[model samples]
Target: MELMILLSLIGAVCSADITAFGQFMISRPIFCGPLFGYILGDIYTGLWLGLIVEMMWINAIPMGVSVPVDLTMMTILSVVWSCTAFQGCQEAAIFALALAIPFAYLYSEVDLGGRLFNTKIMHWIEKGIEQGKEYRITQGIFIGLFLFILRAGIAYFVFFIVGGIIFKQVYSFLPYEVVYGLKKAWYYLPVFGFGAVMYNFRNIKIPFLRK
Candidate 1:
């Protein structure tokens, strides 16, 4: 429970960084994954998995009205599940990544809904200002941020606990060959991710890759 709470807090921070306060890119999987891994005493697992996810979704950038999958959530939840349920198991990391993808998509909807709801809050603040309560604007910002954090924290907590259990149960029953394949995937996935990243930059003159 304590670890879950800590991870939940981290999740909120990462989610907020992606959309709320500092768009410092710390919310990126390359950073967030290792943070979770460090917290769970499995930094290498976290670092490697984070790199893979980061590469795999290298192009999931959000533009104008388009909300891509919440890759931050994917990184956080993947680390939480992989570390807690099956530390040092690449197969588990792969499984966690698979599970994390759909959850990432689900959270994208939640993220969009939250942004929509913020519009209502904006209207409320406007009404308050009409009544001479200009302070409500500041209050509204705080409230919006709090809600963002609350939503992310709760979602991660539930997914960490429930999803972690499901992963553990399912992993325990997998056949050896399948497990070996996943383990192999653990190493190769990053290579694939690197390929994806390179593919994204294929048109650019990346000095080394240019030749």
Candidate 2:
């Protein structure tokens, strides 16, 4: 359990680095999921979950103004939690995936905060230019990265530690009936998510079979 906790904490920091310091693209589940999975020793499940999310949200890009969802943090946290707690259990996978949505929303808030922080940096940049300060742009980038990484790392650390304890205690009392409901819901959520994606694709360029 100690190793499990340590691994999760480390993964969270690394995941933060994806968008916070490194290229934003690597934050995608394609990269981060396998990372959490590898740490938890359940690479297969992590990879599959990442793949599913990647395809389902292929169009959910962060355009100039559009925020979309923070799928990378979602993948990282979900994979870390699921891999640590559930291991290779399908039921746990479903639960983690469901839980990830709320965390994704939380991450969105964090990202928004980062953007707001950038506004302050922007003002500083303006001031720097007026005063003939060199390399304000680089300083701004570093500050942006720092704010993003700090928030993500701290948020993840708290959620996993505090949330993990509660999750274990609560799940211990989960009745079979409730578990069944979760299973049913789990089986269907992906269908809806994937269906929406497929619908979008078919609308843009109808996919078909030539029989």
Candidate 3:
């Protein structure tokens, strides 16, 4: 229970950084995964997994007027589920990650909505400034952070409870071979993520690198 609560809180704080404050790159999987993994007592696999996902997603970051994929969300959910479920079984880890993609996509929708909601709050903040409400800046920032944490915390709580129960039931029915196949993918999934990230970075013409 302590581990679950501790990691869940860390997940919320790191996830908040995905858009809230200190874009010190904590939102990246390379940092987020291992960090959470460490909190849950398995930093090594978490780091490698983080590296794989980080590399694969090196191309999908948000650009002006362009919404990027929810890479951080997936990394966090995957790490949390992997750490919680099977106590570090490499094979089970792969399927947990595979299953998490849809949840990440679902989170993307809710995240977009939250940002849009923030826009309205921003407008109110602007009005408050016009009216000399000097505290609105702090108020607005607090609201943004609060909403972000609330959302992430709730999502983690829900997914952890439900995923834990359902995945256990699902895993019980799977044959050993199927489990091994997933473990094999665990070794390869990182490769896929790394390749995707590298491909995304392909356009960068480094100086004197045969441009």
Candidate 2 regions exceeding 4 Å error are 1-24, 181-190, 204-211
lDDT of 3 at 129: 95
lDDT of candidate 2 over 1-211, digit per residue (tens): 5764575556556556544555556677777778778877999878867876776787776657667777876777677777777688656666676677787787788778778778999999989989998699788877776666667667777777666666656666878887787667645666766876677757463357433
Off by over 4 Å in 3: 200-211
By TM-score: ranked, best first: 1, 3, 2
lDDT of 1 by residue, 178-210 (tens): 889988998899889888888976766658876
Q: Can you list the residue pairs that collide in candidate 1?
A: none
Comparing 2 and 3 by TM-score, which wins?
Answer: 3
What TM-score quantifies how close candidate 2 is to the native fold?
0.80
Cα deviation at 32, candidate 2, in Å, is: 1.9
Clashes of each: 0, 0, 4
Among the numbered candidates, top lDDT falls to: 1
What C-alpha lDDT values do all the predictions have?
0.87, 0.71, 0.76
Best by TM-score: 1
Q: How are the candidates ranked when ordered by lDDT, highest leading?
A: 1, 3, 2
**Candidate 1, poorest ten consecutive residues by summed lDDT:** 202-211
Residue 152 shift from truth in candidate 1, angstroms: 0.4
- What lDDT does model 2 reach? 0.71
